[model samples]
Target: MKLALVGDIGGTNARFALWKNDRIESVRTLAAAEFATPERAIEDYLSALGLPLDSLSSLCLGCAGPVSGEDFRFTNNHWTLNRTAFRNALQLDNLLLINDFTAMALGMTSLRENERIQICPGEAEADRPALVIGPGTGLGVSTLLPDGERGWRVLPGEGGHVDLPIGSLREAALWQQLFAELGHVRAEDILSGSGLVRLYRSICALDNHVPHLTSPAEISSAALAGDPVAEEVLSLFCIWLGRVAGNGVLSLGARGGVYIVGGVIPRFSAFFQSSGFAKSLRSKGCMSHYLEGVPVWLVTAEYPGLEGAGVALQQMLDTPNAA
Candidate 1:
C-alpha cells in the first residue's frame, strides 16, 4: 500500500493527513486565513511531518470550489490554482481534485454506525442516492450516486446558491429584510456560519432594534448560554436547514438517506436534532409520506474529508485507465 497526501480544503479550514493502513493518520488542521495560499499551507503541513515529498505517492485534494480539470478557485477564499502551477509545485502525476462536498459524500460510503447520530432512521435502502449538505463558511451540497462495483460517484453542485424559501410570517419578514438590502438571498445567506450572524442581524432588524455584530461562534455560545435572541437565530438556522434538506430530498429522491454534516449543524447537534429540523424535513405535505421514509442523519466523524480524500485516491489508483 502506497502512502498518499490527502486534504479536505474548505473556506475556513484545511484538513490534511497521510493515508496509510486504509485510514487517515497524522491529521492536521490549518486555518485558511493564516496562509497566503493553499500551496503554502500544504508545504507547511508536509514540513511538520518531517517526511520527504518524494516518499508520497500522490496528492488528492478536495477543494471547496468546482474542480475544472486541475484548476480550481476556492468558493469562499481568494486562492486559485492553475493546473500548471499545481503540477509544477507538487511534481506528482497522480493529483486528483474534487469538490469538497463531493469528498464528504464519498466518505459516507464507508461510514460506521457509531460515526453518525440518527435523526430519522427510516428505511435505508442500499443503492439509493444519498444527499450530503453541510453549512460552514458557506453551504456545501453534494450527492452520492451508486456506481455499482466501481464505487459511489460524487456529484457536487452549487446548490447553496439556490433560492431560499420562507414558509412562515417570521421567515417571510426575514426574507423581506434580507431582500431589501442584498436584492437577493440564497439558501446560504442564512444557512452558513456567516449566515448565522446574518440571521441574527435580520432578526434584530425585524424587531426594529439594532444588533451588535457578532461572529457565528459568539451566537452559538450565546444560544447555549440561554440568550433568547441567539436561541431564536439558532432555531431558525436549524429550521431552514431542514427546509433546504427537504428540498434536496424532493429534488434527488434521495431514498438512501440524507447525511447532514458540516461546520454549523455539527456544533449544535442537540439543538438541531431537537429543533424543527426533523419536523421541517417531514413537513412536505402530500410528499411527507415519501420523505418520512427517507432517513436523515448527522455525521459525527472527525476528519471525514481526510477519509474521503483517501477513498477518492484509492479509487483513482484502482481505475484501469487512471492517469
Candidate 2:
C-alpha cells in the first residue's frame, strides 16, 4: 500500500489522517492532553482506525513549534519529538517534519476559489508573494512566493513574536497594563485567542468594571450577542489582527494578497467583516497607498492543515534529497 500519513499536532488537539494520492482516506483527532507524546497520539489514532503503522510509505508531520535540526519541541504542549526516534519507531522509509504554518502555506495551492473570502479588493499580480497568518494556540506565519513557473515556494516565518506597536491611545494604555504584568508584549500577546481575553480584561479594568472575564469562547459569544464589553474586546482583536497583517504584507510585499487562517477568525467572521480591520490595515502613514491596493482573504476551509501536510509530503517526495 502506497500510504501517506499526515499529522497536524497542536496544543490541545492532534489531527491525524491517512492519504492515498491527494485525497484523505481516513481522518481522526485526539486530545493532546490524553497523550504523553506524539508517538503515543499517532499510535492511538492508527489503532482506532485498525491500521498498521508499517503500512505507511511516506509520513509528514506538521507540528505547532519550531523545527530545530531534526527535532521539534512543541511550544504549547509538552511533547518533544526527535526525527530519528520517530523514524526508527515507525520504521518508515521516508519521513519529513515541517512547521505547521509552512504546511498551511503549501496547502494554499489546493484552496478552492470559494473556500477563501476576499476581505480587501485589489489587483492580484500572479508573480507577487502571498501571505498566510493564523491564530490558534499561538500565531502562525508563513509566506508563499511565486516560483515563476506556476509554482509557489512556501517560507515559514517566526513573525508572531515580533514587537507589537501601539496603534492608538487605547492600545497604548492596554500595552502599559500588559507591560506592567509581563514586561514585554509581542504580537501574539495581543492577537491570539488568549489575547482576546487579555484585551477584554484590559477594557474591563479601564472602564472601572470588575475584571472577572470568561473564556475566549464566552467573550466571542457575548460579542455576538451584543454585549458592549465583549464587542469592544473583539473589535480590538480584529483591529490588531489587521495592523499586524498589514505589517506582514509590507515586509513581504505580498501583492498576490494575504490569507488569514486558523481556529480563531472563523468564529467571528461576520463581526470581523464589519470591524475596523480594513481601516487599521490601510492606516500606514506613508505606505498607506501601497497597502490599500493589496487584497486580503480569510481561509474558511476545514482541515486546511491536514491538506497542507499532504502537500508538504508530496513536495518532499518530489525533491531530489528526499529519501
Candidate 3:
C-alpha cells in the first residue's frame, strides 16, 4: 500500500515514520550526528525498511530550523536540506516543510486528554491563545493563535533567542559571568540540556567550589539522587525555565495556557512540579495576579512531532493549491 512519509529532525535525533490512513507504522529513530547529511540518513532508513522510495506519494518534514523556500538548514547542526533535491532523490510527488516546534504546536490539537499533565487548575479560555515552549537539545518556542471561529493558527517563533532577564542580584551576577564567557545570553543559554550543565558550573564557580560538570544526563542523575550541587543546578534550571515560560505566555497573551514539550522535562516531571517552576512563572511583580490565572500543562505524548507531521501533511493535502 502507498504510504505517507513523516519525519521530525532535531539537533541530535531524527525520527522517521510511515503514516498509512492516519496510523503510524514502522517508526524509527536515528542519531543525526552519525550521518553526514539528512538525505543519506533517510536513504538508509528507507533501505532498512525494504520499501521502495518512489512508491511514497507525499512527505512532510518537521525540521529544527526556519523554513525558507525549498531548502532548510539546521541551526544546531551542519545539515542542509534542499526540498527539490530531496524530492528528486526520493522521487516523491509532493513534499511539505515545517518548523519542528510548529509541528509540535499543530500536534497539540490531536493530543488526548490523558496525554497531558495539567499543572494549573483554571478553565482554558478558547478565545485566548496557547503557548508552547520546550527545552531539548535546544529550546523551542511557538504559539497557537485563535483563528476567528475556525480552530487555531500555529505560529513558530524564535523566542528562545530573546534576551534573558535577570530577576535577582544572584542571577545578575551569574548572567555577568555567562556574558563574559559566551558573549551574549539568550534564553536557550540557560534553558536547555546543555544549559543545565552551565548553570551548575556557574553556581559552583560563585561558591569558589570546583564543579565536576559532565553531560546533562549525568547532572540530572546526580540531582535525582540527592546530590546537593546537582540538586541546586536542577532547581535553578527549573526556576529559569518557568521565568522564560512566563515571558512567552505574556508575549502571546495565552489564556488557553502554556504547554511544555521536550525530552528534558519528561525526565524529571515530579521535580519540575515541586520545584520553583510554577512559583517563578507566576511571580511577576505587579502582574502576579494576572499570571496566576494562566495554567501550565506538560505534554506527555511520545513522538508528538511525528503526529504533527501527519497533521501538517493532511492539511497540506486539503489545501486548494496543494496539487
Candidate 2 segments whose C-alpha is farther than 4 A from its true place = none
Worst 10 residues of 3 by lDDT: 144-153
Every model: Cα RMSD to truth: 2.2, 1.9, 2.1
User: Tens digits of per-residue lDDT for model 3 on 133-247?
Assistant: 9898778889987778454568877888888878888889989889988999999998898898888888888878788868898888889999998998888888888899888
Would you list the rank order by TM-score, best first?
Answer: 2, 1, 3
Poorly placed runs, candidate 3 (over 4 Å): 33-40, 76-78, 148-151
Candidate 1 lDDT, 1-323, residue by residue in tens: 34588998877788999887668989999999999988788888878977755566688998877688656788787778887787677667688888787889889876788999999868877888888998877888888888888587987888899999888998998899999978989999999999999889989988876776489888988898898899999998988989999999899988889999887877788888789988888788888888878888899988788888889988988897885
Q: What is each predicted model's overall lDDT from 0 to 1?
A: 0.85, 0.84, 0.85
Model 1 TM-score?
0.92
The candidate that achieves the highest TM-score relative to the unseen native structure: 2
Root-mean-square deviation of candidate 3: 2.1
In model 3, what is the error at residue 49, expressed in angstroms?
3.7
